[model samples]
Target: MGRIKKKGEAGNAKNFITRTKAVKKLQISLPDFRKLCIWKGIFPREPRSRKRVSKSATSSTTFYYTKDIQYLLHEPLLRKFREQKVLEKKISRALGRGDVTDASRLERNAAQPEKTGKPRYTLDHVIRERYPTFVDALRDLDDCLSMLFLFANLPSTTTVPAKMIARCERLCFEFQHYIIVSRSLRKSFLSIKGIYYQANIQGEDVLWLVPYKFNQRVVGDIDFRIMGTFVEFYMTLLGFVNFRLYSSVGLRYPPKFDKAKDDEAAELGAFKLEGNNALAASSQAPAQVTGGADAETGPDPQTQAQVNKLIRQMREADVEGDEAEVEAGEEETAVDAIDKFEPVAPGGDVLPQPSYSGEETESLFANFTFYLSRETPRQPLEFILRAFGCKRIGWDAVLGGGAYTTDERDPSITHQIVDRPVIQAASQKEDGGDEGETSQQLASNQRMPGRIYVQPQWIWDSINDGELKRPDLYAPGAQLPPHLSPFVQNTQGAYDPTMPLEQQQPEGEGLEDSDEELGEGEEADDSLAVKRIEGAAEGMDLARSDDEEGGDGDNGSFGGFSDDDNAAGEDDADESEDEALAAELQYQRELEAELTGKPVKRDTASPQSKAKVEARKRLAKQAKEEAEELERAKGMLSKKKRKLFEQMQYSNNKKSAEDQKLRAKRRKLEKQKTRAKA
Candidate 1:
């Protein structure tokens, strides 16, 4: 109406482009376009007005930002994709003509991209473009590590190639080695889906999951191609992260790996670290590892010395400059400036300081040499132990090599992790007639003297708690404490297994808080009834005397007051007085139990118990009143809001009820234990 409106002139029609048009513009296959979009951090987007965006828009059609598609037009990877497509065509044409040699030659050129006219392409530029800084990349590493680790654990299939799985595993192992060397591991928790490991790298907390080593079933329901694409991207990202991590610690990237040992299942052991300054300065390496793999011991000692000298020179220059300043302005130099820290937001945390001392925290298992029993999961336990500064790790002989000692009876081993239930002493049978099977069983089951034998959970718990728990509690056959998830933080009013029930429990909701009060509340009501009877008789006499006084005063003043009305009022007052007197007598009995210590009352119930009962009654009444009030308020609310509030109430009530049951269970256990002690 304003003017003959032009088609696709402005708005979403100009901004959005459908997937088909974008693919056509890119001059690549649909799958290739998708891969490029994924690599280049572009995705199919929705236009505000699909009809206006494109006249042919349908429910099946997907849309993308016109700008994102235009940006991808300049991607260098497009050239490689097109070249590969052309190479595939040449191979297919040669094969169609029955020219096997020509097809094979084309494949060779494809393998060796450098031999071709075009340049080789890599995802490095894309990675850098997506994550501008190292910290940004590290922030995104959670998903990368998770995907890679998942693929590493999965079985190889047609869709999931063996080579890809191997690459994922190697990258994971390299990352673990870096963690061990850097001592950056902070916490680990055993979860149902997998084991979660968290590390602090350059002030960023990176957490990743590793699934349990169970036989993973590759069901057809899963689209392995899509997952494999993600795996491909993650593998490259993790490789880069590992390289940076290795070089950061002054160690060589792609540390010399022994494929033979890897085939033998020596995962972390197969790699030999080549270039750390300390390793070069000290020629001592781990025992007997020299013959296993060929790797540089470390960088040249002279180079390290020169670097150290340069750092020292720079520090000296800074010191000399400070000294000159002090001499020039001696008056102000006497006083050094102190920096003040302020919260960025009002009432927020002030100057958040890093509380952890890395060296001290990492040395949890450094002094202890541990041996893992065959039944325990040696792989995860070993990795965790080594990561937290346990260098001298050993396990069963069946578990692949690189252990300091495979012998269970090795005297150097201080801790033995066992998961198997305690087998009754086979040494008894050995002493008798059975020596063959019994001796073998005895050898396997016998505890080494002075060595702490604990369940596998002990290691995880100790690492999470940052202190060694009492080993005796986790001894074989002992009821180990519940392994709570370290990731699940304890919130207010939630049940915490580590804390005593009385501490986290709501006020007066605690169990066995007043042992004497519990006894008092259970008193014989017959004695209380007799006291009430006596108090009622006394109250009746007092009530009558007061009534006579009131009646005489009223008759003198009014001179014609009716006796029936006076009698009715007097009778009602006497009944209320009797009830009050009975309650007072009960209170006195309880108070007597507290002070004079009446054996019957003390054994039965006490003043505190009576008060607790009253408190509970008051709390119940208050809760009921609040609930009624809430119902009234709900009637005023709209249907949707009322329904949401009801759901919230249901959930809160469910949680509170569960907490009550736990507290009650603990209380019952405490009572049973007390009775047993008695």
Candidate 2:
């Protein structure tokens, strides 16, 4: 048998250290320890058995790996924290002794490390340690972008300083500038909670959300201090990312920012990109040739002589023999191949690839210009359209700046995305009298010629389908189809809107099986036939009464029992009386059939039964005429009235859709309950 193990000396006990013990080993306060742990990506650990890690009986012990705690001891920042602790003690002692000036001097010296010749603390090394490669940084960019964007839109409070907010906003703007120049922005969506943006950066897709302007409500439950810490880390990360991106494009990192322009809301325009000197020179060479300035600088005499000699050699070789010509041809082909594979730029450095090549693809809106209305979300629409290769995207002036063309009435604008209901201004009279009032009166239904107007959903649908859908389906007043989630995958036998739910369900699993069980032990067909016979007898009595009132003797009269006799069953009737009664019923039936120009036999295939088909045709025709008249009446309404009518229709349709969603949710919950019960 092995020797008995001591307390806290077996299994994970030796591998883990408690938080309090780690903090003591680092000689730092708990808060400082936590900060170090967060920055270094160290998290608390839970041993398989708490008793093994902690000698105490308490179950709520937080543990960290012994190796991780040992690693923290080597962190340079730990030395700074010790020095801070020492300074704090000195300051407190000096104040206790009433030497205020000494305490002040001590605090001031500690704060200014540069004056004291001590190194200033920075997180640059920590950033490198956390993210070893660029792809690692990108993988973590989603959370970083979300935190920064949220802080940028937040209002400053005592806990959240204004300076931090400004820094976040500046970093976010710089990142946006990179996106604009790179054209890596892919898609965006306007949700009730916030706006979502997805971008493809270096082949990695990153998605983040941004709250609408002035929409964030700061609640007390959230800890701003922790968020501020995260923001600080992300700010440094993004700055480095922006630097790398700008450098890749041959543009100087941290592009010159115009403070005055930024203050005036010149978002992307405020950055002035300066190309690298080498790139600038290379780009200028082509400009010089295109500008015809190279003509003034004639070729050197030696270069011209060399070119002439090369041509003469080539001609002489061609005339000499097939051997010389073959040699020259081989050399020429080799040179051409080398040139074809050579890098386009000097020093074998290739130009950065553009995020979008709009010219090469078959763009859906290649020939159209779009104008977004003020109420619609512009950023997302602009980004998606441009991604699919739409060049000119404009928005109403009310939507602010940064548009290709803000003028809504521009002749070149071929499409407009509007979300609000149409309102036609009253037409103006030739005379000036009461022109305002007349113009206020809505005009008749009309539309602008040569231009198409659609809702904002058209853009999303077109992009998802990879083709342009018919505009009429998404027109302002048109009944739109349900907007299904593009992320949801369709499976066989799944519920579909076009097919009834019952039809999609398997026969063995349907409610019909349960109904059949409940209907067992009953003659369903015979009961149904008896009910139909009773209803037909009542119809015959009504027909007889009508015929009697008309005094038509040609029509047969039924010799059935009176109401009193019918109520009482004829139990005492003799055989002769029953036969006589049955014969009288038969005679009445024949006479009635003869009067109506039909045989006594009930043959539905006879010519007289065709009247039922003619009656159905007449009813269908009347309904068609009524529907046509209603449509014509709608067309006659004024524009304002029509718009109001359309708004009502839209609201009703939206409400119905919401109701359907709620019902579906309830049904899902009910199914879950049933499954649980089973």
Candidate 3:
């Protein structure tokens, strides 16, 4: 009997809405609806069947979730869009008569509060609701951090406002300051997707991506209004996160930034944490305790008297002018000690001496400067370097607006960052005069067809040299910054078991259908049958037939063919035995063959001896299989056993029929191809 239907089983399937229906339900143009959905992060759903909901289902065509449509009606953005359209109409009408002031007045009036109106909704609640706790916010930080960093490095366009870019830059700087002071950075890698950085926070490994210096595109589909709303929310969230991070490390949040040093770094395209003004690093000297706090302190009388004697001797020696010599020798000795062994505790864990450090900054930053585009910001890049704990950064004045030291001869200056290839070419130009002609020539040289090239090799070199300090400098983990990974597909977005050969043979295209069908049949069988056997037997028959046609006596006889058949059967059995061995053994053998390493060998024997050996092997294999089948039968439920048995029989019959049909098809196709060629 058919099973009884459960409650809600038939009618409880999930109902989804189509794009057309959704657009109609919202009473907006399809394009506008699509825009709303994308901005809101709403995703489309797949229907179980076209009969239930599809474009053909109705005259207007398409279906939608009645509930989802009802929820969308409450969207404030949609209402705002509608209101803006009305305001735009009024403004346009006023402007049509050349009433510019009147149009402005009308626009202002429309923006003001009415007597009775709906309260404006902001993204404040969405931010809090999405990220309830600090850690929850941290988890979402990958997306937040990447987006912000990308925007910070982007050029100001109509789609992306300069103000928004500046805000993003400031927030990024604030976040970086927290990273620098806390020194929570662990590791970073340069990736094509972006620079990836990982840090440990509260025993959790937090990874984030940071984009390259400047490589963001303001695409049309991305709704800046929704993004701006999110940015506002994240700005507040990051403010709190930064505060918490600083306070935890016993450092003041928003520590006094030295405007002079900031200006200097900005000029030089580097920011150094001020060591004297505000909360200076020097102020954090280790505490020294005097003798009387814990117990009654008394100096040993003999020791004190001996110290006084040494002091008096030293005073007399100083009178002799030997103190200066002693001081110089001590300084040398201290320098030697520093050279011999200097230990550091990175992240509060004992580590060997750093491979890169401040002492190497001169060499590190030597010729170290970036030439920014006319559109690139000098402050943001400088701030970024400082945030990553690099106090010595330099950029070309073409970018820093002559606010920086442009002296290439300056020994202290290290790294140089440049975006324009023309800057590099012009600076390296042989002739200094005819600047206009030189620039035009350089501009022409810079143009490359079919590519908007941003050289990341400079970033990579700096990162590898350990000059770029941001934890996420090298795009690592999920924190890969934007455009860090290059555009390339490692694999075609499809599955093919036989595809691995494409790598081996570059000239090879796709496998033919006949070959694929054969492969599929073989793989489906899940048996250790040798494909070479059929071909080998045919070859043996042809050899014998040729010998017979030549009238070769014993060699042409069918008697020896009996032994050949037996030998081939024995080899097939041995191959089947190898197939059932451990998968690792098979893999290792293949690997060894590829490497031209030593291959494992089996003792060779005559076909009759091999047959005897394989016969025993087959018996053992059958015994193991029978025992496993018995165990499985005992454990399985009766209903499951019946179902499994039926499934096996159905599969076997289906496979037999498919094999026959495939053979027929293969013959027909071969015949057709031959005819076409003829």
Candidate 4:
């Protein structure tokens, strides 16, 4: 028998701790403990078997990992909490003694850490510990960015201070500036709930949602305190992430923020990005020096000599007809030049150099100028478009200022993004009836020739696809395709709606054979029908020609015969022709039956055949009536309403097709997984 185990020493009892116990062990209040856990990435844990962990049967107990609680013991912020508790005790004791001056002094001393030579506690170390690498931090950035952006847009309330809101807004703007400068923003979508933005940072796609400006309604259902705590943690996390991202591209972190400009709502333009000259010089100096010396010193002597030698060798090799040797010599000379160049500054830090290939850094939208309609969200659209390299962006005057050109009829505008429904009314003529009127007088739906008009989603689709989509697909009043999530990865055996059915199938091996068989069967049936019809026609033609020949012979042989004899002769000939035709058709049917392996049957008309045919006609007539009724119902709707209904039907059909494709893909994956397991 095994030795008896002590109480609370068996199973998960030793591995898990209750929240109450954890708070007491940390010597902090519940709120403080919660804040610390959030900052340090510690979360509540559930035991596999509650009975094994707890002696009593209580369902309301919240458990955490024992090791996580133990790890929290070493956190630097824990000491700060203890120091605050001590200070509070000191102030309370002074107040109890009626020493107001001592109490005030104690409070001032506790608040001013600078005078005490003790710096404020920071989450920098925790940030490093939580995210071991920059990519890890980026992977977790979606939640951080989403939380911060949400708080930034929230109205300041009693629970949420104005200062916190301002800080969140500032941090968000600074982050947006980096994205704009780097052109990492990929896609954005305007939804009924809020605006969704996706950016590719360090190859990790980060998507966050920002609410529409001045549209967030604070509700009582949400606990602002909890949200505020989360916002606090994310604020620190995003700051570190921004620093790493900026420094990676040779730009200074914490870009200069202008309070005045920010207060004026300048957005991204308010911040100034400073370059890290030391880093840039270190990375580019080698390439510059290798190509040639600085303009002040001219080309280096040794490099010039090598270049001349390479040229001479190339000429000599060309004369000798050895092109390979000449190419090899040129490559060798280029490599030698690169190798000989050294860094000018000794003992300098060798930072990771950033790749600056022009092709890799090509702008997503380099050629087109866009105009935004009044109904569209101008601010988000402008920022996203400009970030992607659309320089000339115009908008309606009603959307406010800072536009490249407010004139909607600017002939140079290549693409216009309008969210409003298409207007069917023609342009109204003025009293003068002049052809050359101002652009504003033109009808709302009148499209400019040679320019493409699209919905707002066209820009997002183009950016996400990394190329221009067909303009007609996203044109105003056209039924738009289902917008799929970019985050979803297409796995093997997944059916993509964008791909054709033939490609989705497995090489069409069996399907091709079946289709060929069907085609051959159809062709055989058609050939048989055509041969039978031609045979019937030929038999009739032969009978007619024989009758005419016989009549001519009779007329010559018996010229004096009466008309009755002639009629009798014609009847007999007709009977003989009928018999011959019947025999020929019977023989043909027999032959066909032999070849097809089927029994031949006599052709006899049945009484029920007519009734069956009539029933089929009645059903077809009913179907036609129902279709006509639907058509009449549709005709009752106005033109605009009819168009909208058609659009709705088309959208529904598209959605159904997309859903079917996704279901097929899911089933295929499940089947494959099952087979693999088996």
Candidate 5:
């Protein structure tokens, strides 16, 4: 026979451990345990049966897998945490004994370990252990980049230090340098909250948003400590990723950073890169060594993975010689090759391709030089131009010093992006003021000769359309066209303002165009209907009182008295409608006789007019055709899918109605303008 198992010794009890127990097992404080879990990529676990795992389990109780807790025992960061705890105790003891100087000294030494000859811990191993491959890191870099960029723009608060903000900004610039060099940027969008960007790096698509350059308001709701923890980890991760990317292209990592240019907010211009010969003995060198340079070079993704492998080897070699911090058994870290997630091609025949002799859209702006007005956003314009193969871009002197030319009259400029309004030489404002002329024109804004002046939106619209848009439409002070979002895909049957009206309008609305156009006034011709509604309301009140009073059905006269009062009410309504129709017909006949200057003869027995009969029949035919089409479509869908399709039809019809209303308003305004001119 086998030995009997004890309670809380096997199965669920053995597998699951509570948060308190995990913290105890790791021999660290709760905060330290949280940090460790975050760095090691460990999360809370839920057991199938809480009662089986722990007899006292409750909804608030947090649990973790026993194996994960056990694995945390070998983490090198645990030693640093324990060391910090001891240092804290030493500082507290000194303060309690009134040795304030000693306590302050301990704190300063711990804070500045380099100056004090004390070794500080870096999360190098944790970064490698968490993400074994560079692509793995890149896949998760979306959140990292967004958070870092946001904090980089935020003001320094008591919660978030200035140094942290500076470092975040520096890292973000470094990452953008890599993006520019690689030319991996695929798309950009201008959104109200921020600008969004999508890039394809190493066949993996990454999308992230950057806040507009407005003063960031750090609200009270955010927990800076938690975000700071994440920022710390991401900083290390991105550094390593940058190193791998730079090494892949045989370019030096950390390139050259110019403090003077950075101080002046020269941004992307502050960093310069060189070939591999610029490398020092190790990768831990400072960023200030290299000088400033332009972003004219980048790395190839084909060799990124290979470079990561080499870096991993170097990391492993460096860790192997460390002074007895981690145990021999714990030193075994098997960082496997990248786990690829390639998209499978659909099984279908290949289609023919269209060839063109025109320049590719990637180089559409390559031949032209652009000069931006002072009012235009220099950074976004510069980035877009550089990404799309435009080499020489100039801006105002106040903006920065890195432009190709600060002079607006630069002869080489082919395009000038201006956001200012038109100036009429001040004549319209001064001389024509007494004549009620609106001073809507600028006084002195002249355009340079041989340069096409367009609004800032022209650049974005041209890039999105994959061709240069007509310059006349986007000219300054030319009632610029609506700047549509590039990210919103145009769907079939949806109302898009950019598309022709006749193409996407609903069938029913298009048919009613004649009636809509012929309508003379906005007021409704409902005089008879209003009288009938008043009469109906008087009868409805009397009926409601009768029902409340429990009166017998004695009011209906002339063989109409019955127990059912609803049928009598319906008959009364029919009689009232027929009387209203008779009154309308009599009025129409009188009007016709007055217009023709002849007596109007009544023909009660005559059939409906031929036009009316044909119109009714034609409407019936159209409705029948529509019903048949709907049936055919419905036959191909399941009941649930049919309901969803009907919902989409309702939404599309509503949107089409709105678009038609807008179009009608515009037509009315245009007619008013024409009448005023006449």
Candidate 6:
């Protein structure tokens, strides 16, 4: 047969109309036109120019596919909209007759139809229409995936319903499961807005975001309807992509979700294959019954046997390593190399191995369980982590309480995870035995989990620490996923095991010189107390005082530390200034009370007292001069400083003049002393 022309290639020259002209032909608003096109899988045509459609010899307009427009006229939504418009006119006519009930009834009937359209919108159709093939869809998945995943984590409202959110969540989770099972997860990051994850699916790298756990607020400012429309399109796109992914790995599409395991918060759980032993037993048998059986029986038997053989081979191909079990009879294969398969051409076509070795699986995971306190919130990090095989996880009540399978103290836990301000659990006496507690308590508790905690960095740390040394349990070969956090510094910094410092530039590195150039900043900051003990004690005391005072009396001895702590060590020197001001204020008030001859109030001071004494002396001597002009004082030695103040004032008149004056005075005093010493 002759080669068939591509779908739109052989169409007549006048078959298509400009998108603009199509909107005019529909006699509808542009937005409505666009919506119809999108709903009908119509795309903006490559503009062939204004001359393409000319009503007048000199005028032209853009065009769209005439066939696409004709197809759109039959859309059920269009008919609904038109029906609604007609009813709206009827309602207006009834209202004009002063028949309110009739108008209202008509309005209600017009708004909804007895039966809605079919759910013909499938992801495969959308993919075929837009991308033509699976790889093409995968290549353009970045933005669509990222946006959909973001919306999936957002709180559902009227515009973005719980149902749509749930659908997006499930689709995203299914995709993540594919990554986990296939060991395709790559890098992940904990960003301010959300956790960013990248996975390599059949050589195509897909990156997406999962928002910080429970940080989503359904704000009124955001137009959820618009976002929901986008979400609707994405949900369908992801569904097809997931189907393709699962089929590629020989797994069933729409992997069986354990509804019992899926919690109210929608945390994903392990999904087991269907049918079990009975199906397996039947799958292995041949179809031939006996010689008396029909001729069809023999081929059936042969097909069954062949299928069983193929199934076994496929299972073998998917297996990675035997790291979890070892025996004297078995040889040690480098677990890391298990996933790396030699390139092979099967049936005249080349495809990467369906899965990697056991070591690769372990390395791909090598993750730890994060235990949050009652104070924290579980972020939407599970998807990103699981996508990369950061399995075997658990967390405290802080993040999606009760979502984890077990508490952090479970013996199976290889690494214990905690974030900043970790509330160390008081050592509990083991009533039974001392088993996995040591490893869980020490190392993992030190690192701070950023406000948005992503588990990928934890996975990377676990692998690097040789926590993944047990190949069967953790690190596995070429499939080992990398740390995803951009915040994770890879520098071989100075090693200080005792200190919980971040990865930094190594000693004798150029960073030291750059820091030295910052001068005395290198001198250890003495403003803060040497240890956290001082602040912890203060906090405890404050909490106790608040309790004792019964929330009424001022607990002067241990006021709430929140105000001071919020300022941190930055307010150290300012504390002295605060005290001095308090004393001056007390003196001034006392003086006012004394002058009025009212029984000297507790808060007042006399003019002769400490408050006004200094002020009076300073003013008497400087009365002739304006309080040292701010710019003049700051200038000290350089006219440039004065000019800077003048120029800044010109640009920004709202800046505080009093602040400028204070800063200038301080600068002048420093210069005067330096000049005297010289």
Which candidate number would show the highest TM-score if scored against the true structure?
A: 1
Question: What TM-score does candidate 3 reach?
Answer: 0.41
CA lDDT of each candidate? Answer: 0.76, 0.66, 0.51, 0.72, 0.72, 0.52
Q: Of the pair 1 and 4, which is ahead by TM-score?
A: 1
Model 3 C-alpha lDDT per residue in residues 35-107, reported as the tens digit of each score: 5554454656545565544335545444455566677788766776677667888899989989999998976
- Model 5: per-residue lDDT, tens digit, 322-365? 75645544544433333444435763333433434324765778
Comparing 3 and 5 by TM-score, which wins? 5
> lDDT tens digits, residues 129-237, model 6?
6777788878878877887778777776656666667777778777766665566766655567766666677788777766665667666787665565566677777
lDDT winner:
1
**Model 5 worst lDDT window (10 residues):** 517-526
lDDT of 2 by residue, 603-677 (tens): 223232233323433454467657756566778899999889889878876865664564465446556667778
Q: Evaluate residue 59 in candidate 2 and report its C-alpha lDDT on the 0 to 100 scale.
A: 68
Candidate 6 TM-score over all chains jointly: 0.46
Candidate 4 ranges beyond 4 A from true positions: 1-6, 9-11, 87-120, 187-196, 259-264, 279-362, 396-402, 407-412, 426-451, 489-678
Clashes of each: 4, 1, 37, 0, 1, 31
**Span of ten consecutive residues with least summed lDDT in model 6:** 284-293
- Tens-digit per-residue lDDT, 1-678, candidate 1: 478768897888888888888889999998888788777778878766778888888888898888899898889889988998999999999999999999998898785522443435678888878888888889999999989999999998878877778888989998988887777888898888999999989789999999999999989999877777777778778878888877676666788899888877888899987765554334332321232223435657999999999999999899879977767786665454444677778746557344425566688998999988777898899888987888898877678777778766778989988888777865444445544521123355677679898999999899888889899899989877889887775656778787887687776675234443233324546335544555466455655555455445523223456767755665587567556766666677688777887752432445655565556445655786578567668889999999999899999999999988888777777777787788
Show where candidate 3 strays beyond 4 Å.
1-41, 53-102, 109-121, 192-194, 201-209, 214-678
Ranking by TM-score: 1, 5, 2, 4, 6, 3
- For all the candidates, what are their Cα RMSDs to the real structure? 11.5, 20.1, 18.7, 21.4, 15.9, 21.2
